[model samples]
Target chain A: MEQLEYEFDGAGSLRQSGPAVLVGVVSSGNLEVLVESAELGGRGRVVVNTSVRGFGEIWQAVLTDFAGRHNLANLLISINDAGATPAVVSLRLDQAAEEFYRGEP
Target chain B: MTTTSCGTAGQSYYEANALKRITSLLDPGSFHEIIRPEEKISSPHLRILGQPCSFNDGIIVGAGRLAGKKVLIAGQEGGFMGGAVGEVHGAKLTGLLQRATEEGPDGVLLLLESGGVRLHEANAGLIAVSEIIRSVLAARVAGVPVIGLIGGVYGCFGGMGIVARCCNALIISEEGRMGLSGPEVIETTMGVEEFDASDRALVWRTVGGKHRYLIGEVQRLVDDDVAAFRAAAIELLNDPRPLSLEELQKEHGMLSDRLKSCSSAYDAIDIWHTMGIAEPETLPLLDTAAFHKAVQHVYRGAA
Candidate 1:
């Protein structure tokens, strides 16, 4: 088991402030992402707790790529991963973000 | 492309996913998930074991309308760890049943597809299942009907099997199986001579929908298709029947009588004969409707 946390500065901010939004399932080769409105000072923070160990670099790379692609500012993204590929992790993060902002004013 | 609606042709409840089951069983677009995936209320114990945790803890509970009546729907995601019940998963079910009692839903539909208590969190899962049973009993006592829909890949086994049995009425498809221990477990513990796990037909004949229906364990038997399942749900929800104390007492008497009559009967065919079925060997080959028709003459109890 490995626990890693990272922070990234993003250009965009969350439009809505509400309880956390969760998406995806944590089965084999799958992961769950939780997106919550936060007081991150225009930065996005990510915390990953995974069963597959010794993948710190992979986690950082995937999350970094997601943060770079999306302007997830003032938000906290927490993930519970179970050996999901980079594609699945990115997709789940993107989905959680989309669901988080689906009905914002 | 033609847009096929739920319960339309080509959709089978036995093959549909948990989410699909919820959608098809209720009125179109009527299901509202409680503690949905985005809530991320996963199992804390699975995290300690370094295992993946599902956002809804592998069970989906929500409010829905069935036949114009308000109802609560619960479906298990069997793809997630065989739909095993852990601490969070069990509590979600318990809470849902409790909600049904307090909210006074016309009925509660439980789409059970679990292999029972998760070995990873055995004690917590067991205790939670017990709590769920308590809630089921409470809902019945409150005059809220609780129905079990059992038809999924894993089927309902272990503690979940007992929970299904506790329902006011159980609706099962030919593919649904209900029993305490799985055939593999029984074979390993009691030897292949006692129970052969490799014989799929024999196992189904012992615990599958047809046999359960014949034995009066199941209240309704429908085809594997989603339309059939939805129809059964609609009928039950529209006319909610909470189990009565007199009915419970009658069922208890029947079970005790069966226990005495079949104390040494290992084969289901023998039990079938005792139940007054003339030709038990031909039962497994019949479809749901035909099987129901055939058993009507032999079935004597208040199913």
Candidate 2:
């Protein structure tokens, strides 16, 4: 199979202020996340290690949109995707971000 | 089905390649590989695609001794399709837990490393993982300890990450990662300029093991070495309250608190600084021991 791995370093309060961190796995139509708080100074990051590569542009767009939409200035979001689609990924990222920040069960 | 490669997948073999800290966690030779690769547990769905099958369904299940107590162990073989869980693979895993419940194994140790369900056997794989989780919950109800170990490249992700979180206990090494969605998809839906999925430091800061431990999501954070993991598993097995209700509540509360704490905006470093931890810049870079000793945890004691 094809696998790709990389780490993303985001900027500003978007990186550190997030008392929450979201970790997840990417599969088509679905995703899982581990959202917890961090100590990094709000410069949160999103590391992507996936089996489906050659789509760096798409990934950047999705993450940037989520950060701006939710104002995720403090958390780092990490993920690994096999072949999950855009909708599934966004839902999970938002859910994870919400879980970490909102404290919803 | 390439039986030749199966034999090399023995516990010792896995032990050898396994993260260095995880070694010696279970009893010396108690590992009993179920659905052994040699058994040729291939994904039934693959036959339709004219693809060769694999033994153990890419998942190795069986019993092993963690210290002196008997512990059921299941590990994913990532070499096969990124170690996704397929129908047969999922069944074997569930079956192992089912049998463990029936026979009353001393404890259950899941050497979990998966990318969730196998697309080829989508529905079956999904059901298998779901059932497997139910079975593990059953084991927990029956007083059998369940330890979910995440210390590999694929790690506990997708639906499986939920399973891992639902388990009685969780252990994560640096090499392992758990999340719901990958960045590319998020970027596509949310926009590349918004998420910037290519940033490495950004990712690790959010979902990496250290933060999970800090927020008390992960019970233990050890070195990536297999031996350390093995030791932790062994220690957990010997304890009477290997997986206690009190601990689960604490974890659940952490989740709840996080959900409640969110506003329109949030970030990792701000969380840390607010928690009163100093010099936040290199926090994620700190090793397990260093972080544990250095950072001041926001949540003290258990729930």
Candidate 3:
């Protein structure tokens, strides 16, 4: 397993402060994303723990693209991946963000 | 969209994840998870073994309400490690049952979808399963009824099958299967000729919900829909069958009778035939309603 961490500047904070929103599941070729409000000093942080090794560069590119698309200020995005592709990772991240913004249980 | 108190119509419980099952089965907005995913409490042994870890250790546990009644609930994520029980996952379930004994909830609903103990952490997982069984019995002894719902993709097998049987009652769907040994494991251990794992029809007939309900192994058999499961759970909470010495004796007598009657039976069809069902071959093709109608006359109070 490889652990990857990335920090990005936030575009804005979340609309509502609520409990964490989780999306997806850690299965073969799938991943789980947990998005929660945290004290990150106005910056977004993502921690990825993946079973697929030697993908640090790809994770960086995908996380960078994700951070660029969403306003992740004061949010911590933790991912537990099991060989998910970049497209699935991106989709789960977006879904988690949507759930977080909607304040879903 | 027509939504009931539990969830929208036509939502398949077999496809839903652990959290989705819990939220959809319970009263809307009533599930408050004990250990949130953000807390990042996962299996400690997985990382060292080069395996990706789930945030909540593949099981979600917390307090919730079923049809306006207080209840404690737990759901196993079948997608994660086949919903196998490890140290943390088992502890969470044990803790919840212990809480149920103390707080004395209306009931404890267990959404069991596990294949069994995790082989990666073999000893710890096995020990955890034992502890969970004891805790479940303890809660039942304290007058807290424990109900199990088995309709997930992975089905319930291995140690979890024992756990499900220990519950006061079980609500299963056609897709849910409960057995001590899984088909694949049997095929691997005793050759495909002995138990063909690829034969889905044979596997279902042996351990699936329809057969289990007909044989009285499960209390209720409903459709695969989440709404159906929710309704069944609400109805069952009104009738909690706590364990008793008389119940055990009755169960033992039923088991002995079954062994004597079915010892020479070749397959589940033969068992069904012995149970006095005419045209037992047609059972597998029948829908849930038709299956119930066909077996209404047969004595199904035995295990």
Which scores higher on DockQ, 1 or 2? 1
Q: List TM-score per model, in order.
A: 0.83, 0.66, 0.96
Report iRMS values in order.
Answer: 2.4, 11.3, 0.6
Cα lDDT for residue B300, candidate 2: 57
Which residue pairs does candidate 3 place in steric collision?
A: none
| lDDT score at residue B71, model 1, on the 0-100 scale | 91
TM-score of chain B of 1: 0.94
Model 3: chain B TM-score vs. truth?
A: 0.97
What's every prediction's RMSD, in angstroms?
3.6, 20.2, 2.0
Q: Model 2 chain A, poorest ten-residue lDDT window?
A: A18-27
Tens digits of per-residue lDDT, candidate 3, B137-177, equal 99999999999999999999999999999999999999999
TM-score, B chain alone, candidates in order: 0.94, 0.85, 0.97
Model 3 interface Cα RMSD in Å? 0.6
* Residue A9, model 2, lDDT: 41
lDDT of 1 by residue, B1-303 (tens): 132542356578887778878887788889888886666788889878767777778899999988778999899988788899999999989999999889898899999999999999989999998999999999999999999999898889999999998998889988999999988889999999989989999989988988887677887788998778878877776666657877888889878877898887779988888878878889889987778787888786335
* Interface root-mean-square deviation, candidate 1: 2.4
Best model number under TM-score: 3
Alpha-carbon local distance difference test for all models: 0.84, 0.63, 0.90
DockQ of each: 0.46, 0.02, 0.93
